[model samples]
Target: MSAALVLDFGGPVLLTPFELVADQPGTPAYELLHQRGPLATAEQPDQVWEDLQAGRITERAYWDARAEQWHESGGEEPDIRAMIAHLYDPPRPELVREHARALVRDAREAGRRIGILTNDLRAFHSEEWIERIEIVGDMDVVVDGSVEGHLKPDPRLYELLAERLGVSYAEMVFLDDQRTNIRGAEALGIASVWFDVTDPDTSYAEVRQLLGLPPDGAQHG
Candidate 1:
């Protein structure tokens, strides 16, 4: 059986929402953070974000708090989906990471199953905008927590992906940006790579090695 390559949607498959907002200053997303507070601004360190990174708070709790703060700042209803829409309305293909796209292409060409396991695809993005994302359609499977009603670290979510992909946990290679999620996959005997957003190339290289694919720029043979 072919091994499956499963990736997290946010930081692995695309430039994280935080990175998108930071890269495009003077945009509505940047202005939302600037006006609201330093939830994302580097100059003004955000304790909430730090806590989330430290694993002191759950990802859901972090977003819930941000939604409340956004509403209090006169943005809109206290829903994370509303906040995500304001930050990433158009959802252009440019939001996807080039390396991620390349990796997926190579993995598919190698005859390996590719899947996206995300906590908030439907929750954070609109159906119209999601349709505009071509990379998402390329996946062999997409297991979304919002749709499944089970988030990462939940064994059932991982099990569901394995079942859908028709692969055993040991036959799957998972990549995610969150340490907690990585640990969860590791606990299930799945080979997991922690995608480092700061240095995506290294992470992709590791994934390539795990998938037994040729190194970047090397001949496929």
Candidate 2:
């Protein structure tokens, strides 16, 4: 009665720039303002964040618009994009790396099969970020959203992963930083752990305990 484990990459294993926006106060809300001008006061920050996340507007477009608006308003400032980049550039959090690799390690020692389930774009596949990470056991399968064009929160993605692993949804354990993603897996009868991601001090040992794995197999920092 071995278990199956699926891990999500974003928030859990990587620090995205959008998550660090609050850290950069000097950067204009829109990159265009610094490059060309300032943004109208009516434009909301949340809207900008969404547009950036969805890739609705190019970073350069936003910066250019900001620069124009700021200049028209007679505000003097530097380029916002460069300033924000310095604050929120994506970097691998070592704690995330350590524990994520450990999660794979623990699952292997518990005699469980391992795989990765992540929402990513073409770059993630092209860059081989999945292959770069060292998992303790062999990754039996990979269900990436960008490759399949079917992202998570869609139960089909989870189903596809289970099919490739040759396991029932009820037999799999899903780990994700997002609660919505976790709920999606649960709806399909997959056991789940809501990884806080930023903290890295998750109760993953409890998951091992539930699987009846030896305590020594679980790693704690």
Candidate 3:
């Protein structure tokens, strides 16, 4: 049976600024990086991140909350926009993408459905960024957490994706870097691939093999 390929945008398909933090953990550039990701610190829950993704909280509001949290922890006043800007205002480079793009092209050409399910509504929905990424046009569906008001691990989001893809939940092969998100999809009967997202070759190779596609679909992939 032809299956729908459901991919998580950030870590699985392409690396983002948040995942890049570990590389420069001790530098001046990395100090505010600690205030990144869904859970900025170990003690804080991901509630604010969820709110940001779900459109319940504005971007500025989310940062304000982070700032308040920092003060509570006895950290001095933080430059919230500086950190947010560092992530948002970058030349977004690809960690790995060519093979993934080829797979999308080939799969679509062969009549299989493709979709991206991400907590990244902010960028993918934006005209400029979507054009920059170049896969938005190729995808049969794009599920943005903010637009949908439902983030991943929420069964409703998967249901919406299946509806949009015109496929059953199980017919979609879901791939994500986070284990919790993988388990969430699995709970609803979707076969999930736990991607080691930081390592491009391994994760991409596994995805290629799983989809029954040739090794390195792109010329340089």
The prediction achieving the highest TM-score against the true structure is 1
1-221 per-residue lDDT for model 1 (tens digits): 33899999988887766666776576545654542322344656777766766778778887898778768767689888888887677878788988888899899888999999999999898788889999999999999999999999899999999999999999999999888889889998999998877779999999999999888756544
For residues 1-221, what per-residue lDDT tens digits would candidate 3 score against the true structure?
Answer: 53888888766666544566556666544554445654265675466666655656654565667655545554455555444444444435454366567767767766778999986546333556556666666788988876788876788999999999999986778888666678779899887787764466777666666666567755334
Give the TM-scores of the predictions, in the order they appear.
0.87, 0.60, 0.68
Q: What is candidate 2's lDDT per residue for 61-142, written digit by digit as tens?
A: 5445544555554445544433333433342334145545566677776678777787653323334433344451257777
Q: What is the lDDT of residue 85 in candidate 2?
A: 38
> Please, what is the whole-model Cα lDDT of each candidate in the order they appear?
0.83, 0.58, 0.67
Clashing pairs in 3: none
Q: How many clashes in each candidate? A: 0, 20, 0
Q: How high is the lDDT of residue 111 in model 2?
A: 77
Clashing pairs in 1: none
Give the C-alpha lDDT of model 3: 0.67
Q: Kindly give the stretch of ten consecutive residues in candidate 3 with the minimal lDDT sum.
A: 82-91
